[model samples]
Target: MTDQTIIWLVLGAISGSFINGLTGTGTALFALGFYLVALPPLQAVAIVALMSVLAGLQGLWVVRAAIRSNLPRLARFLLPALIGVPLGVGLLASIDAGTLRLAIATLLIVHGVYFGFRTTLPRFRARTPIIDGVIGFIGGLFGGAASVSGAIPSLWLSLRPWPKAKVRAVLQPFNVVVLAMTVGLLFFQGAYNERAIHALLITIPIGFVSAQAGIFVFRRIGDTTFRRLLIGLSLLMGIGIALQELF
Candidate 1:
């Protein structure tokens, strides 16, 4: 890779690690800012999928005990999401790269705008497994298509009355598994190559180090302010991505 490309990967890894550490998710949306500039949309999505696995695994490790204790709740979301992943991967392979990027940009923009002003929406009681499964399916579909699978679950849990820790416990592992499945499918389909593997090698260590720094920062701040900042940043990035791709 050229020096410029390496620089973008490093920056993306740092940004993604920070976002993942602070919020336990949204790494793909935040880091895509740099990846999309350096690689084609499809390769960017693939690389993000690999990094996302690392993020989810790290988050799960932080709450490993909680996950072990919540098996029933975990099953409520995990099973159907796995079932839905192949379908989503199928969709990914069928679309042209440009159109897929546009769709991803649109999803990011819509998610950002909605969550950024979430208080405007009426609150409702958190529902049961069926809804969770549906969200899981949607999350899987999005994950397969763009590597931002956690975005749907993250936003869904935010609307619920569940504790923040509980939300992270569920969403993080779910993202890891779903994206893991995506990566496997992509590998079988021959989406990975020497270039993607090389890029991953450069970014993974940086991701781990930056994420630890982010977790330290997260512990120091209040959740309310962090939520606002996360959503606001997502919105701005989404707008920038959409504009860059569409025009």
Candidate 2:
């Protein structure tokens, strides 16, 4: 690979993995743009998916207690999401992925801007299994179609009156599992050629180190700060998506 391509790959790895470490989601939102600058779309997506899963595994450990305590709640989102993925994959042939991504970006921007400035953040105190399932399903659909499984759920979970770990327990593993499946699909489709493997070998270690740094920051932040960070990330992610697509 060229030096320029290597630089972008390293940058993407550090940025994406760090975000995943801190927030348990948003690897693609932070990293994909850099990857696209250096590689083709399929290769970029493939690399991001694998990196997301690898980085997310560390996040899973950080939130292990929350995940174990809330298996039923997590399952409520995950099971439906699993079913939704195949349907989403099917829709790809018919749907314009860029249009779908743009629509999601708009929704994220609206949600972020509306809640971002509020002195009091919104919270869903009561149990809402049905809504969680729907969001998970939609997240899965986006994951399958656009490699953006975390967008919907991350937005939804940020509104919950739960601790940061609890919120991440849902978001982290959901993206990891969904994107693991996505990686498998891509593998079968021959997205992981020799070059892609070489890229992964070079960047994965850098991603791991960056993720550790992020987790360090994540552990130090208060819950309120973490929530605010999520809101800001959503807004930034929306802007990133819009620019990446429009440009």
The residue-by-residue lDDT of candidate 2 on 1-247, one tens digit each, is 8999999999999999999999988899889989989888888999999999999999899989999998999998999899888888999999999999899899999989998989998887998989989998998988898777988888888888788888888888998899999999999999999888989998899999999999999999998889888888888888888888898
How do the residues 4-111 of candidate 1 rate in per-residue lDDT, one tens digit apiece?
Answer: 999999999999887787777767766877987888766777787778788767777776887887778877888888877777767866766456556655765676
Error at 169, model 1, angstroms: 0.7
User: Model-by-model lDDT, in order?
Assistant: 0.73, 0.90
How do all models score by TM-score? 0.82, 0.98
True-structure RMSD, every candidate: 3.2, 0.9
**Least well predicted 10-residue stretch by lDDT in candidate 2:** 145-154
Using TM-score, give the best candidate's number.
Answer: 2
Q: What is the lDDT of residue 234 in candidate 2?
A: 87
Residue pairs that clash (backbone atoms under 3 angstroms), model 2: none
- Identify the candidate with maximal lDDT: 2
Error of 1 at 207 (Å): 1.0
